[model samples]
Target chain A: MHLNYYQKEDQVLLAVDCIIFGFDKENLKILLIKRNFEPEKGKWSLIGGFLKKNENLDEAAVRVLETLTGLNDIYLEQIHTYSKIDRDPGQRTISVAYFALIDVDSHHFDGIQIDAAHWFDIKEAPNLIFDHNEMVQKAKARLKRRALSKPIGFELLPEKFTMRQLQNLYESILDKKLDKRNFINKINSLDVLIKLDEKDMSVSRKGAYLYVFDKDKYEKKVEEDGFIFKI
Target chain B: MHLNYYQKEDQVLLAVDCIIFGFDKENLKILLIKRNFEPEKGKWSLIGGFLKKNENLDEAAVRVLETLTGLNDIYLEQIHTYSKIDRDPGQRTISVAYFALIDVDSHHFDGIQIDAAHWFDIKEAPNLIFDHNEMVQKAKARLKRRALSKPIGFELLPEKFTMRQLQNLYESILDKKLDKRNFINKINSLDVLIKLDEKDMSVSRKGAYLYVFDKDKYEKKVEEDGFIFKI
Candidate 1:
């Protein structure tokens, strides 16, 4: 049974591009893979793949990211769709851009060895092909906004992190120097962190106390009083 | 030159759905058109059309809106793209949903005599076709979030609107009863309104002062100090 009611409508090739963000306790980075095939072969581009008929856009995005990093259950969000007619010179393709966050030390790339894939600091990333650079800039802007309103920055941090490390993550994502006292005061007011007795002695002699994100408490607060996470 | 390098991928029909939100002075309304075509004909759905091979998504949305309402130079935004595979049972169609704000009293539909079109209050809107109800919900959520971060509610107002009218617009969109004094205080603090000597006498015996959104001042403030419009 061929149900082709929209035969007159023009069909388009859709692709999903993933802007994988990771934090290395110092700087924010993005995973980019060298395009193996032309029109711009060997150029560094966001890891992407064409959407198949059997899968939806989210599934396609997940598949594309998994095919490169071999990681699942990552925090992925569909940011925007780029549909300039000539966005892709090789063909008329509309790419749905998704941003994913991962903790650098936790997610090891042990699935598949793609020598072309490399992680570059967001600031030093080379000019990508097509409308990919635009996509990156848009994704970064979305990440910045999301960081202010949501606790998504935890996705890019380890399970147990020090206050300084968390503050550094914020500064990196926001690309601004946040006053130390003010940042700590705001985070403390959120009341979504479990301050552990253990201290991280790696950064300084008088180590800082580590903390883990209290997801249960956060959920409870949200359920009871409609808590909004704002930075 | 016929460039067909990527022929080994699936192609899907792309559509753009417009969630046309209009303010009828007191309540937020959405303009819906009855689907005259197959599968779900006669059912109310967001005004939409299939994307042509020539135009981009934004252009496609603008054309779709104009084809129905004959209005141009409207404030339009690409909200999100829906791709649930079975979202459109007519075909494997991916629809990009855009939410447009229009002043209901100002923009008279004089272009096309589409008898099927009607405006329904947001709360009283009918169950839309396919995943349209979902699209509407998402668009409304986006509108609520955007209204808090940006001064987009002004797009749904007339050139000279009373403070009460502006408050009503916000209340309608937020679906909440706001404190009048607090709301006025916040709006005044933003300093983006020019309180004119004219008054809106239609609403009450004691006429309220009409204010016009000072775009020049807002732009200057934004340019000089990166002022974020938050309500």
Candidate 2:
């Protein structure tokens, strides 16, 4: 089963690591799991797995995310690939890092497989094993850049969310205090949200009106004018 | 030397393909080479090579570019990874695609290694082998995105370039006509360019002033104010 052309080449382990990001009411969080294997056993690490022979890297990332959170159809993006020679102490492995956004309240974990997994505030995340911390930093920078040019932040919010909640998500990701009036003006200019009669009563006495992202209008705008959703 | 943990896992051949982009006065071009080996012999393909055991993906990419162009310290970026199982017909090779920007006139080729290489206008590029076309498309999109957020357009331009030449590079990358006044205003707003007194008289009777990208100012601005060079 050996091929002559590839015989002299080195074949190394290829793995995929997921920087699963979630948003609660107050802050941004990341999903971290305690490793159960050797060479870095019982330490916090990004939820990752080796790529299977039958699957592509994207599929492997999805499988890893599903294995941890029992969630399907999440918003996932391949952030970057880390291939430092000594990035992994145990082996010369190249990891393709992916960032995923999920609504925190909607997807509850399946207890059996992810007993060691926990959500950590992105700011207070524990030091991770084998370049996982570097992966997190890169993913966060990518998420911030993406949040500016695209409407991907909506993926971290619930289906119905208030404008203040959306602003909070952006502020948390960008880690800057945005002018409230300016933020509202910019969002209104984009015209990608639809206001609903329902109210989010949990936040204030005079509840803010709920809004949903207008996917149809967004797609149409993108197709027609190449609209860029800049914040 | 088989590790017990990796005994049952699959290992595939990893390769790196670089889409080398160059800018001429009139249009953008790509460097493509005729394949000299099996599985795609004699066909036009990207400048590429298999990754070596000791080097990481970036190093492999740099090596491949240097082999073809005989240049170092050029602008190179990893665009994406192509891991479709059947992408390479000769073997199950996963290619990490990179896009490199070089000044075509500045870096001459090393004759012996790049005998079959040729520069083709991006619009008139030939059909490439084994999903290379898709890789080129992705790289172009990434370059466009990067050009907007960073001062990467200067990478494709000569050190001392006229304002019209700079605008043309942007128009070619974005594939749209931008208003001259608007574009100039935006560039002026960035304040990351040094206008030189030297003029280029090749294009018109009244010469256009030349300018150079201020790398130090741009870096300092990025560090100080989180500057985004949006155009």
Candidate 3:
């Protein structure tokens, strides 16, 4: 399989950029890392690294995550790729954007090289480097769509979360007010959650019951009849 | 501006692949071309070409679509990139998949060369080359989601379409048997359609009224208040 026909085509640098989405109490935050390289040195940029040899985009994303956060084994999905000729001013590079949702407190960070990684409130994010702001916008759109159609939002929040936290997470991502009753009705109709005999009273006087996604039951039901989790 | 640090990294081939979706009457079809190149010659493949020096990914997608359809100015969007190590059995190449919607009868076939290009009924599409089938599935999923949340479905269908045709298109894409009365009620409630007096008598004796999406009105109303067109 010779496959050398495209060898002479303009070979441009490729980057794997990650948008780490995390949820804190009420607001959604995006992780930004200070660029250590010369092109955008010290400027706030997405957590990114050049795709290394022998690594595919997913592995590259995981490597980027591990390099920045000192953590692995997270949910990362390739959202879209940005390849405008001038997206990166320093060179003609194509960047494949991935969105990763990790529970904020789950991954530990040692006091070392990973200090540059910090979570910023999505609305208050600093001026980003290159076309990263556009990437964030696109990632947010994908997150919103995924949140509505699937149960992936649970990945961003804590494993055991109250119903209010879930609702707030949706509202933060969607930037719209959702009726509590209507939201609960819609979510409950999906029949994919398991109510644990636990309550979290941190945010309210009357504690809310905690729930965890029943993965096995959900997977079975999803296979039997597509359990659409409409938001 | 010295990118010398990355000069030694693996410079793999990059290509833009397109899933051209077209709607004929009520059938949702995708335009696919047979591969005539070495690695997978004479097999069913996606419409694709390698990224050029001066062109971006979107530009490459447009170029590939124009080259295949012999026409320019089509609606195309970058869905996701496939970067699995063995996705392309011939070599380790990264492919950015773009999904496009084109009017069925509007493309020009002049000056286009390669293996045969034809529309495929999505469900019955043959075994494609490499991971092309997965790309098609993702594109169809995006199309269905977009159809429900935006006015993209109208791009695939003709300017004027009967309610039954539109409903059938939705049914075909979503792979569900929707109740006719409920489907009509939901679409009518959207208030973005202009119902003409013409009836489509081709499909039935009673016929259905012809309607075209009022672009200006739909744009205006969607801006003022979000719309959800569902079946």
Candidate 4:
């Protein structure tokens, strides 16, 4: 194919922005970075970078996340694309936004990069640079919708978690207090968890039973009946 | 800002392809045009064009659709962006795929363009150029999911339609047989429809009551409580 066919078309910059979501014991937080480059020099912003010539958007997103967080093989989903004419003041660049879920305690943050990156509670995150705040809001909404039908919430939890911990994670993400009995009932109906023999003794004297997500069973159920994990 | 800042980066060609969906009485169809340009000339393909320098991706998609259908303000949604390195054979181009829903009986088709553009039942659509077949599959899946939670199915129907026509639209898009009684029960529970005294006798001897989607009521209900219209 002749390159001249596309020569007349305008070539624009493409960037990828990552909305890193983390869940601690009490809050849902987002990983934000302080911009150290021109155009937004000192403002808070999403961890982002321009797409390279040899890489696709997903690879660019993964590279950006790995460069900042020192994490690999994390849960990442493409949520939306932002393409306003002046979204980026530096140029007319289009950005693909990805939402990533990582356990708050699992990743190792580079000390130098850690100085610029911080996990802020979702509600407390400051106004971000350019259209990044809008990107974060869209990612959060996608996360909320996805959590209702998929077992992706497990990506935010540790390998072994207590029932109360699971409920707290949902309540934090959904931003609503759920009835304990009702929540438990709905989760049990999904039948995608393995109740372990051990118990977590840190939160209470009696201890709540620990449960782990049963991936095999979930896949089987999904294949059998198009199962929807609703809470 | 100096253009030299991004001059070293490899600029890529961006294109937008529209999956135009239309619903007839008994089938769901997609509009595909025969490509008249090189690198797959004369092959059936989705209506597509490269993004110009001054235009956003959405604008490009609308331009492509309007050029063929001469319709504006249709229900167009950005479904996904395909950026595989070799998905397009002609060049390293990233295509944003949009799914548009149009009332088949409402839009006017230009006679000259109609000679090259044809509507094919989605299931019977010819092998499309590039990865457009895959794009259609992805858009169809999204349309199925969106129809269940949102009232977007109305976009494929006329302003006034009968309950039977509505159920048929859902069945065709879902590619399944639905229990009529159960479908009506679910739609009525949502309480977002106005049953009119008028009747449509075209499909049956006795005529079914016509209904119109109540956009205002639906929005109000959505605001009051997080409404999930499950079928």
The top-ranked prediction according to lDDT is 1
What lDDT score goes with residue B165 in model 3? 79
lDDT of 1 by residue, B1-231 (tens): 225457878899999999999997789999998887788888999999899999999999989888887878888888888999898877889999998999999987854626778999999999999899999998998888666655655679999998888899989987888898999998888788999999899878988888898998765554432234344
DockQ of 3: 0.42
lDDT of 3 by residue, A73-93 (tens): 888988878888888766677
Sort by TM-score, top down from the best: 1, 4, 2, 3
What is candidate 1's lDDT per residue for A4-39, written digit by digit as tens? 558977989999999999998888999898887788
DockQ (C-alpha based) per candidate is: 0.50, 0.42, 0.42, 0.44
Candidate 4's C-alpha lDDT?
A: 0.82
Local distance difference test, each candidate:
0.84, 0.83, 0.79, 0.82
Which candidate would rank higher by DockQ, 3 or 4?
Answer: 4
> With candidate 1 superimposed using the best TM-score fit, by how many Å does residue A49's alpha carbon deviate from the native?
0.5
Per model, the share of native interface contacts recovered reads: 0.60, 0.32, 0.47, 0.31
Q: How much lDDT does candidate 1 score?
A: 0.84
Candidate 2 regions exceeding 4 Å error are A1-3, A219-231, B220-231
Kindly give the stretch of ten consecutive residues in candidate 2 chain A with the minimal lDDT sum. Answer: A222-231
Where does model 3 exceed 4 Å of error? A1-4, A176-195, A201-209, A216-231, B176-178, B199-208, B220-230
DockQ (C-alpha) of model 2? Answer: 0.42
Error of 2 at B208 (Å): 3.2
